[model samples]
Target: MAEQTITERIGSADQVLGVSRREIMEQMIDFYKLGDGDGMRQMFEAYKNWEVRYRDGKRTIDETIELAKDNFDCVARVADGYIDSGDTTVGMVRAVQLPKSTSGPISEFYRKTIDYQPFDPNRN
Candidate 1:
């Protein structure tokens, strides 16, 4: 079987950066897990740059832990600073309902209904 282009599956968009928006986001927890300052800094940078293009995933351990109230206050800042920086759409979000699957792994998949218009700070 053949795979569909991002648009063919997602419908419409100016660009399809990658499967996931950012690597730091996925690794944010790792930074906390290892108490790695460097990883934390990198995650912070990635968080600040919310619209950074898709990044390749790196080797990381799977774990979850609790953060201090102060730390959560700090990390909660991630929810801010997102804005549409350009006219073109940068990403998409899949609906809750799953469409029929194509051949291959199902862990990472795009949908056929939407072109995610997320916050981009570069719009002028």
Candidate 2:
């Protein structure tokens, strides 16, 4: 049988932009070989599905949000990055901080942050 194309398997901008579903699966296998847990597998699958859903049917802005809410819930905290920046009395930047677990250190844990863009010295 002919090998399936990435586009045929996962037709998503995420696949087009960077790695593909097959690649993600391969990476997961590698991680598993190294004794990774089921949690990692779950994360990879969830992330991949979200990417595919996000790219489905030329979705609109509202549709994208709805799709995202439906697919990935654990990492949805990232969307809440902008907590109380402007107009709010507190003026505090809120974010979701993942607790330290078997996955990794607390410092290395994923957290929702207002600053999405990478640090660029030239931009300033």
Candidate 3:
């Protein structure tokens, strides 16, 4: 069997995970640019594992995507040198020792603040 390219692997994962293939490919490309092949592999593995574990369950695809997102976020943070020391009274505090700015699509997603709009049944 021939080896699959990264895009092919990501496409397969997107089908299994019920996520947008474009999103997965973008993330994989970001990791590749950072030279973090292991992180990209981990993200893909997490998706596969989630599919197997929840294949016959009542869990929704959104839940699985959230789990995958968490894994991706942790890997990205770690790659930027944010080590998880332990939980604090406030919450889990990651020790940010690296001087690099957390500027990326994933970082932006995590940092975005939600603005709630009033319910308008007629809008949609």
| C-alpha lDDT score of every prediction, in listed order | 0.26, 0.35, 0.45
Measured by lDDT, the strongest candidate is 3
**Candidate 2 residue-wise lDDT, 1-124, digit = tens:** 9864332334334444354433543433344445544434344445546555556678775566544333322232222221212222221122224321212211112211111222224453
Count of clashes in candidate 2 = 0
Q: lDDT: which is higher, 1 or 2?
A: 2
Best by TM-score: 3
lDDT of 1 at 70: 20
What RMSD does each model have against the real structure?
18.7, 13.7, 11.2
- Of the two candidates 2 and 3, the one with more favorable TM-score, higher being better, is 3
For model 3, the stretches where C-alpha displacement exceeds 4 angstroms are: 1-3, 13-58, 82-124
What TM-score would each prediction reach against the true structure?
0.23, 0.25, 0.34
Name the lDDT value of residue 15 in candidate 3: 33
Candidate 2 positional error at 118, Å: 38
Q: Which candidate do you rate higher for TM-score, 1 or 3?
A: 3
lDDT of 3 by residue, 1-124 (tens): 9975544554465335555444454565476567665666565665646564655556576666555555454444443332122222111123134322433443333223111122224454
Worst 10 residues of 1 by lDDT: 103-112
Higher-lDDT candidate of 2 and 3: 3
Error of 2 at 69 (Å): 15
